[model samples]
Target: MNNKPVGRAPNFTNACIVMFGVNITWVLVVIWSLWGLLAAVFLGLGVNHLIERGRVWAAARQAASIRRGKRF
Candidate 1:
């Protein structure tokens, strides 16, 4: 029986890790000082941008790999 998993699991894992790291950093910033709230807001926005870009990159890479007849 074939046991290989399907789809972009690595990309999902990377995205989740990035999101978790961003949230933890934000929490730490909030705990550090009230002044850090602004920084946290910007950080959150940056993280969102990064996640979107990463997904796009991953999808493109996956498609290329598929076209090459290989698993990503």
Candidate 2:
């Protein structure tokens, strides 16, 4: 299984549906849409940071785990 995160883009899509389908839910929909955008920006930053240093980080962590004789 792939463990990569897909993040929060779906909330915006849900917001669009709610905005068109039910006027009463528009406020909630807007909140969800904003939340999705915030989550996406953070997710993008995190992934970029990880991609830039992931190999080195992963290798170091793996070595530490092996040295400690930890098993998954």
Pick by lDDT: which candidate is best? 1
Once fitted onto the true fold, the runs of candidate 1 whose alpha carbons sit more than 4 angstroms away are: 1-28, 31-34
TM-score of 2: 0.29
lDDT per residue (tens digit) for residues 1-72 in model 1: 988888663558788889988987868587547756667677678878998999999999999999999999
lDDT, candidate 1, at 9: 35
Instruction: Give the number of the best model, judged by TM-score.
Output: 1
lDDT score for residue 29 of model 2: 53
Tens digits of per-residue lDDT, candidate 2, 1-72, equal: 999998865558778866755753454457558787666566556756877798888888888998999952
What CA root-mean-square deviation does each model show from the true structure?
A: 7.7, 14.7
Model 1 CA lDDT for position 44: 70
For candidate 1, give the lDDT: 0.82
Task: Give me the displacement of residue 34 in model 2, in angstroms.
Answer: 22
